[model samples]
Target: MATAIRRLLTAAVLLAAAAAAPARAGTLPPLVDVAWLEARLGDPALLILDVRGPLDGEDVVPFERAHIPGSVHTDYLKDGWRTTVEGVPFVLPPVDRLEVLLGDLGIDETRTVVVVPYGSTSTGFGTAARVYWTLRVLGHDAVTILDGGFLTWRADPARPVETGPSVPEPALFEAKPRLDWVVDTREVERALRDDAALLVDARPEDQYAGRTVKPGVQAAGHIPGALNLPESVFFVPGSGRLKPVRELAALVPGTVRGFAGPIITYCNTGHWAATLWFVMHELLGMEDVRLYDASMVGWAADPKRPVERAVPASG
Candidate 1:
């Protein structure tokens, strides 16, 4: 009972902090625009994580040069947040490892984490979504993604940017895995047999059609019976912003009805699929969504698994 009460009190305090944040009216959503983030730059409960890519395994010079004030830098590519298991790349690390990682970054259950990416393209934005998904899978509910990310932040010269490393006092991070949000190869195979879930392919059209293939996977085609909604469709190129919810929903296939049904999203290594999961669950408010974390790499590892490519009508 004491633990329950403490949790309730912590929740209340976080809620009050959010309510008092300088954000624009209507409250913050899972995706916050630059304007919204700019307004809440000093909220004590807010933690901005700038996950810029470390090109060619080099140092994070871009983050070292400038970042949002009070933000911390973590190289998404270099970080062990995603790892390989049995040759499958980009799989989530174990719970203890994630706890140490998040704790070292000064994250805790009480804080509201806003993941920031470079926002150069869908690929960059996917970094934010993948991190956001990781936090969610670890049961961190008070997380959001910075729409337009650091690119949008820098576009506004007036917004303050800071240089030099900012060391934060570490916090105790507790990992509470939400297994329902994750699925594996066996579960996906069962879903295919039972027709119990809508499988959404987050790969590009050519990839989904097996015309283009990514390395590290045995098969080029997508899982049989999956719907195609390439992750790139969610972003406007060169704009650094995701499409509005109405626009995103319009892109959904007409065959799929209702947001409550189970939907499993997958890409080559779960990187792209994280973007789709964020769009459907976080932005669209869809429920019963899960990510195939192993994605195509794991699915295609076995020779027995089936892959299907939609053949364009012969011209």
Candidate 2:
């Protein structure tokens, strides 16, 4: 009983602080740490979106068990974040659907959204990145991701965690879609034909080399002229956290670093490609970086499209 009272008192203090705080304006960073979040706990303009889900053998922890105070929960995998359109799986949902989803979450242009993932693996981090990309493509610039996610937040015992569900008051969320941030198969073909954009394949080397293929994708190799750079390299070794900016820049090949053309990133289902897109577009601040959301699955569905297999060097 005493513990419950203490928790309530902590929440009250945070709420009071938030009510007294002045509104902040200006651009938000692409990523924020636990310390930065903890300081802004009760701010009314801040909305903490906890997107925890089953990924990489980790069981989903119920939001009622424990979550950051004032944070809302949404399952990244099961939620209507992505949908199939014209047989292409995992493509962005329609604008009206996205508007309803965001509005239901009490997300509007006035609030700054912070997306938190499970942060257990690189794939798990991709969930947050994918959501971030969705928001950016929707023309929402007041968004940022929680680096290291809930795992890092839970690592510290000093941070206050609340139990029970959080219900947000619904708000009107308008969608302002940005066509340039997303590219279609026709656009990709045109770019390839014109040698206009640098295509990047964010898949494992074996898959990129045609040695392995995913289940749903029809092709066994990468898009022709695409450079292979697996998304795993962006994360720190054995952790979900991203590497420092300088280190991340160093990982890019000289060819990619020197290329001045627009860049298009893709993977099997556009899941992994979202991470690469986040790194290049958001973290690196590269201009004209776009995501081929349909990715290999859509590309290979057309048998007429060309696929390339990297020739192995002779021993």
Output the number of the lDDT-best candidate.
2
**Model 1 Cα lDDT, one tens digit per residue, 115-143:** 99877777878888989999989988788
TM-score of each: 0.86, 0.88
lDDT of each: 0.81, 0.84
Error of 2 at 177 (Å): 1.5
User: What TM-score does structure 2 among the candidates reach?
Assistant: 0.88
In model 1, where is the ten-residue run with the lowest total lDDT? 17-26
- Flag clash pairs in model 2: none
Q: What's model 2's lDDT at 133?
A: 90
Where model 2 places Cα greater than 4 Å from the true spot, the runs are 1-26, 311-315
Winning model by TM-score: 2
